[model samples]
Target chain A: MIRHHLSDALLMGYSAGQLPEAFNLVVASHISMCDECRARLASFDAVGGALLDASVDDLGESDAAVPESSLAATMARIRAAGPVERTRPQVAPRRGLLPAPLSRYVGGDLDAIRWKPVGGGVRQAILPTDKAASARLLFIPAGAAVPDHGHRGTELTLVLQGAFSDASERFGPGDLEIATAADEHSPVAEQGMDCICLAATDAPLKFNTLLPRMLQPFLRI
Target chain B: MVRSESVTRADKPGEASVSKLVGKDEMNGTAEWVAEMLLVASNSDEAAFAHLFGHFGPRVKAFLIKSGTEPAVAEECMQEVMATVWQKAHMFDPARASVATWIFTIARNRRIDILRRSRRPEPEDLPWGPEPEADPADAVSLQQESRILGEALKDLPDKQRELIEKAYFGDMTHGEIARVTGLPLGTIKSRIRLALEKLRQSMT
Candidate 1:
């Protein structure tokens, strides 16, 4: 059973278009693999519909742009643009645990990733995305542990393959762990298999130990 | 949430004009009429398309502007969105969503596209939000769900609702909301989370 899940705040953030770019990627990938979250998000969208339908106060026509030419201009544009092709809803599901949303980031599947060694047995490949936030694909060999570190800002870590145990709890595929400024943990990959995770962080990691702290600046984690 | 009767009443602003020729007897069918207008517009029916443009255009513009879009850009986006509505009308299913929900989503997506294009200097960029999925479900069920959600939202405390409105309608981040409201980040998250929990409990 998929126990660990996205916090209500994250899902709501995703639904409302309020999340920053990097965190949104984690949410999208997790939702694709978790049906429960998908259903929950659908409910949120329904609420959005309800809000739009009832909201008459904000949509005051008096303040809206009413130049009649806009209608004509829009009509001309639509006429000029010609027809839009209908989109197919769902393709056959890809073989990988990384959903289409995440797969595109790495170019293809698990084998397609070009992992860069950060430290110890933990390796990561930073995905090119918004400069305000950063995302990366992490690979940890079995029995390897990430250094115990706190967060200066929020970091969302989603496991795409294998399982890992942190101070909080064990997380598997589709499980999301939200580590904020108050939280600190060293996550260890379960011995049965290699662990691969998609992580997004807005700030540098705050290492708890002297060795990791000294190495942190060069590690750029 | 939507009372069945309020839903019929919800279309008053749109049907009030169409009712001039179609008569008041057809007013209850207003939601279906909007969906049909999309279908008709797909077939290049200029009158039907123009009517849709007139009704949804201004509202979409206002919605975009509330999200920090400039009026000029919002106006441009509004036109672009309506044009997409016409071109992709076949995708609009009255059964799976109400007209308001459908149009709101279209407007939201269009605004996001515009925002992304303006910000991202990269040639190959991925979207930040969940891509719209094509779910085909019963029309009345989705409407009832939306109405229930609306009702659930009404029951929430004003303080909680204010946060939600900022997050959803105004496009404020949790941190941004904290800065503006002078509340701590933890407090803002807790309030919104609690209110959402109540909404989830009541709706499901």
Candidate 2:
């Protein structure tokens, strides 16, 4: 069972389409693995639906109106776009290690990643996202430890393969760990298998070590 | 704690006069809209599409404008949203979402694209093989629940409702939602959570 899930704030932000691209990616990747959160996200979307319906009724009481030509113009655009061939929603099989949304960013699964050694036994591949935030896939060998650090802003780390444990708790595959500015910890990979994580952060990590801090500028972590 | 509020809303719909709020006519209209979407999907019926536009077009336009979009751009975005409704009608699953809910999602994405100019990554679509038609009973029950939820929103206090509206209108951030609303996010979340549980039970 997945112990950790997306917070109400993050889920609602995603449902509202307000989160940064990197955060959105992490939220989507987590949902791809956790159905409970998927259902919860649907509930949030339903609220948006409720508001949209209410606004229509409010429009009659208020002064807002659609221009008279709006329908004709929209129909014209539809015609210009030409015929659309209807197709059923296709099934997207999960590629190994990565979910569909994450895979799209990496262009494929584990082997597709272009890994760069970040010292220690840890490697990372930064996924392209908007400037507001950053997302990267971290690969930690079995029994390896990520350096101790604190978050400058909110950080979301989803274990996609294997498991990891920090001072707080253990996070297995499909589990998400949400750390805020107040949190600081060192995470070590479990002994049985290598741990691969999709992690996103709004601000850079506050590394405790001088070496990692020096490499931070070059690594863009 | 928020779960308690949702239970109250679900168990005591009559206190809010939710039945009266939805009204018979509104319930019928919901079903009618679903049928029209099916017509668009199966027959590519222009008349049905026009009917949908006549009802939802102004609302979508207003939604865009409220979210800080310029009037001219809002008009254009509304057009694209409607066109997309036509193109993706085949994907509509009444068992999962009402027409308004589906349209709201499309509009929300459009708002992000225009207002934020950033990508909005969606959860992977649930993988399923060739499927049978969605059960009509499931669809009807789900739509009924949606109307009840809409009525419940109308019953919220003005401050609470406005806070919720601001979030949807893109005027509030996620962190601000709990702070500005004063009431815990759980209250709103629990309310929606009830609806989700019902939806899951029906699907099963």
Candidate 3:
């Protein structure tokens, strides 16, 4: 385990944007895996918001020239291209650039998975596990959720499309969720669109319902 | 709490001294303003960029000077940092960090690059130590948080803060800090770890 604990000071530093770059990256990565930290950060954000609302004319302004039409045009072009679409697009070629353990799940061609509808109009492709570990990708219609269930072991999910929120925080595209054995939360895709996520699991699901529990044995994830 | 006690011992003097210098409310305000400016700049507002540059450019230059860079080199690094701001403004994410924090990071990285380049022995001329620490009076004129941080920094056992300043402000790697400080690599790492923990506690 990492020696660091997510304290209020760290959360405030993160939300107020005071951490060193390397430290910030470490905290960001940690928050992805640790919901407790995420919740604390959210609280810090609230405090920051309240503080900002009460203050006025506090920060100094620097005099730097803004880019001309050339930069503006480039940004407009990129924005017009629209958001990248793919319920489970191929693991970006940048997967190699990630740390080793993270790269393992994203190594293969991500587009090849066969998506099958499970429930709530969500499609899932249970990726074949190389060893004892199991991984799956879920594509949920807007405001949908998988059957209510809990994980038996570690489950890592990365949002590939749209956004989703559980009881705690909302995750957008490129956001990762690393859930361990103790975490038990169900996420619902935001309204008006579908949410697609890449999920890697180490064990089978523990469905709340007896019927789904029976089906879990036959199901791949 | 087992580890907390040892950490508290390192920070006690610095924390007490710095706490008297600044109010938490003022620091919060400064942080918020920086975040707002960053948001405006990211939106492609030329005026906003100018406002930010005017305010932060000198601060960045001053920080470099304190880190031991010559005025000329500090000015160059400041310009480079602003140029990066212009080029990578879109990468600014308010959710991630405030503008001052982001600019400081850029400045820190640039300072590191300059120091690294200076480390090589030039055939014609030898590199000198970084410009003398910035004027103590000028350093004092900064915001309360900066003053507090600077004071707290001074209160740290010199050996520990020196390694930290070299690694962070000077951008020296662990091995380089070890070489300059004449401490073992493991010792340097332990000092930094302890220093960071102390800094975190003091800030709280």
Candidate 4:
């Protein structure tokens, strides 16, 4: 069972289709693992639904008129689209180390990931997303620790494999740690197994150590 | 419970009371649309599809345009959205989502695709088939809750309501939403939990 879940702001932004691509991916991945967040996200969607159901007069907009032939055109489009398949009982595909949404970006499961060493025993692969934010998969060897760092904007880290313990708490699989600007610490991979995480940041991180800070420009961490 | 959270200091108190009086009509309207959607799902009924299109098409277009899509593009996307509704009508589950809520999800997805040029990752589907048949009692209760939620939205103070609308219409970024509005979400959250409990039972 997942302990930490997404914030309301993230959920609502996702429901409204307004979050950055990287943030959306993280939210989607987390929701895949957490039923509580899934239900909460649906609630946020219902808000969007409520807004859509509003009458033209209620919104005080007299100008949102569709053309007379629009319905006929949609009907024509429907005919061209062909019939839908009969509804089938869909069991969710078995979840691997990566959730379904993350798998789409990686193209497969954990073995499919292409990892590059950032430094020390940590490896990272930056996923392609818009300029607004960055998402990456992180691999930290057992008993290793990332350099101390502070965030410029917000950092969302979701544990996908093994466990990691930071100053705050131990984050096992499906637990999300949302670190804001005020937080600064090094997260160490717990003993026994390598820790792999999906982490997204809206802004660049500030490494506390001078060496790591210098490497930041080249590493894009 | 949904009402009390939003009943604070309505700018137009008279208008708030007026909407309360019409709440019954809104609930009836939702039920009628749900029935119409079922007809389309079961029989591929053109008449029912057309009726749904008549009510929702303009609203969807307006929604897209408000989100800053060009009017022509919005109209085109609106057509695609309606087509998807027809093609995927068999997936409609009134026990889980009202017809308007279902359509809103489609419109939101289309808006993201046409404007953002980015993939919107969706959560994995809950392991379940479409309702073999919608539960009438569950459907009505869900509809009633949604109507009350809508009224609560209208009764919100203008500033609060506008902030919520701005978040939905793409005027506010996710970061901005964190700063701009502590939304009146107590009621909405409870309603969702209620719906989720019902859904969980049906799954079993």
Candidate 5:
């Protein structure tokens, strides 16, 4: 069981569809690993559904956007989807710990990724998401220390494999370590296993060193 | 004619917390009705689907509009959302959630997927993933949890509830909520945090 689970607030953001894609990816993947959170999310989803029920029907501006033939249009879309196909989820993970939700981004599993070195023996592949935020698959060799940095905004780093010890805690698979302006620490990969994490950041890192600052512009991370 | 009593109970001054007072048995029946309708729809039963569409579509459109999406976009998104619900009907498990909750979740996620589709220009099935597998717990237990959550939401003070709505239903960030409500960011955070924490305790 993952000790540090996503909070109800964050999960609410997720079920409400308010979370950025990066955080969404992290939460989705974590839910796949953590059943407790998954169940909790179901509760949140139920709450969302009930709220929708309680919401009064107002044929307001948004309702004006719908064509009178919306039901017909929906039926048309379903018919176009074909009759006999077993619902193949658009983004299916053929097989891996990546889970189906995160796999679609990388196009495949761990081996499919073509990682590039980002200094300090750490390698990263920036996953294409959106301008609102950036997501990447990061790899840290055993015993390597990530450059100490503070977050300018929000950063969610979810461990996919192995473990890493930050300033105060060791994060293992399914553990998501969130960092904000208030927290800054060098996350060091524990010895005996390589640490792989799916990291997402809404803003650039506030690095303490001169070298990292200079490279930030070119790296666009 | 099968209306939701729990929904109306919110306004029934005497039933300030009808969600808690209502036993699991009454809710289980409601949960099953929607589930069966979805199951029938999955088999291409038009009448059942139309029933769901009639109930959920307008609400979904209103929700999107409230969340700040353009009216046309909300309507368009609502259609797409209902379409997915129709196609994915077989996936709905009442054991995990009530039908209203499931449909609401689909609309919310579909809205997100549509928004992202514009930003990343990629054909993706997002807001899309397999629904969670049913927990080992009995069906009644799941319904009970849902009831608790619904009541927990009702028990929140009106101001807190408003902020929670903006947070979840309006899909606004803390900053966006602060801007709209004209309150300090910290106050916004506390209200929502306390509300959610209450929900958390209720679940436990």
Candidate 6:
């Protein structure tokens, strides 16, 4: 089985308009199977177009390029249109957990926090950061060990609040740790506050502990 | 020497004379006129805005459809994109891209946003702020087909080429293409399968 989908590379081709017609068909087919790739493709298209639009020339030479309307008027229209917040409707909050507002930086419910019990009295919510598989955010409570495991994905964590320490590095609020899939490390939150972090994961976690490995089926983390 | 096309007089009750000017082409007419009107609109000319709206609105709508937007969504997004154009007329820097590319980009972004929203559950509101103003430095520099896939596309088996164009440009589904093209669905699928492999190898 192909371990990783090739849709991202295909999307890059599409965005560049370099994908030949034959390849374009295959990429489209692959996109139907891969939600992650679909979202990335959408992002690439949006960002690429916006970049192109920003570079265009002004309307004619004789006219001074200023709109007839005042800035206040435009702002008023936007205000009337209301704040364009892109938050998805929640499915009822899971049992005892409170529903957190999904992040707008990524698309849709893909950013929702899915909490799973890891081990050692710790529960982790996997938060997808964006459409691209590069990053995810993991939230863990105080004094919890995330199990002795290595990542099967790239992991970048931004400590939102509280502190956590791995063998070599100590992470505090606002500190970011960038780790690759090959990195082998386990993190434990300090005794004080819960460690909340934004992490980007490229794939599943490879648990090194037998207990976590056994629990993986039930925990679904 | 030009003959008079028309002459309107006040009190003498004389008939008007028509003047004919030679070498006038329609191509030279609308582009220059539209460009002039946009210039005026940019200068805060209210009349110019009206003129531009009457002319470009339909064209923009058609452009959106061609770019793969659904009709209803395209219409709504077109309005918003035009409003944005009006609001940000002063910020347009001509050194980077042509006017068509700029307008097309706005429509494209709006379409993407709508697509993203449709994929998820409808929320009470969208969370992101309005798209930021365009950066001056990020203009599309690569206009030429850098990878040159012409030969690769030509080399594709006819069955593969037909399915691809229908799928990508025509926006037909695999099953739909099968019905219309009279090819077995599996045959269509595998043709595309091999086509992609060959194309990727060549392009990369």
Best of the candidates, TM-score: 4
Show model 5 residue runs off by greater than 4 Å. Answer: A57-95, B1-29, B38-43, B69-76, B113-137, B174-204
In DockQ terms, which candidate is top?
Answer: 4
Model 4, span A81-155: residue lDDT tens: 776775745766566778888998998999999999988989999898887889999999999998889999999
Best-to-worst ranking by DockQ: 4, 2, 5, 1, 6, 3
What stretches of model 6 exceed 4 Å from their correct place? Answer: A1-116, A126-143, B1-80, B83-109, B114-204
- For candidate 2 chain A, the 10 contiguous residues with the lowest summed lDDT are A56-65
Could you give candidate 5's per-residue lDDT for residues A93-168 as a string of tens digits? 2358676667788888899888989898999999877677788899999999889999877888999888999877
Q: All candidates' lDDT scores?
A: 0.65, 0.78, 0.47, 0.78, 0.66, 0.42
* Rank ordering of all candidates by lDDT, starting from the highest: 2, 4, 5, 1, 3, 6
Q: What's the C-alpha lDDT at position A111 in model 2?
A: 94
Model 5 chain B — which ten-residue stretch has the worst lDDT? B117-126
Better of 1 and 6 by TM-score: 1
DockQ of each: 0.23, 0.40, 0.03, 0.44, 0.26, 0.04
Q: Could you give candidate 1's per-residue lDDT for residues A1-221 as a string of tens digits?
A: 67888776776666666676777788888877765665565555555555655454555666566578988988789769876565434444367766887887788888889988877988988887776678889998988998888998888899988999997599988788888888988899999899999998878888888987887767666
Give the CAPRI rating of model 1: incorrect
lDDT of the structure predicted as candidate 1: 0.65
Candidate 5 yields a Cα-based lDDT of 0.66
Query: Each model's RMSD to truth, in Å?
Result: 8.1, 7.6, 19.7, 7.6, 8.4, 17.4
lDDT per residue (tens digit) for residues A12-91 in model 3: 44443434332343345445444345434543343332222211221222222222342444334434655323121222
Chain A TM value for model 5 = 0.86
Question: In model 4, what lDDT does residue B65 have?
Answer: 80
Interface RMSD of candidate 6, in Å, is 13.2
TM-score of chain B of each: 0.54, 0.75, 0.45, 0.78, 0.57, 0.41
Find the 10 residues in a row with the least total lDDT in model 2 chain B: B10-19
Cα lDDT tens digits for candidate 6, B1-204: 111111111011211000011123322222222233334333444444444444444445554454466766555655677666665554432222234434544554465465541112111111211222222122111111101122244456777655544433234432243333321122222322433343235334
The TM-score obtained by model 6 is: 0.37
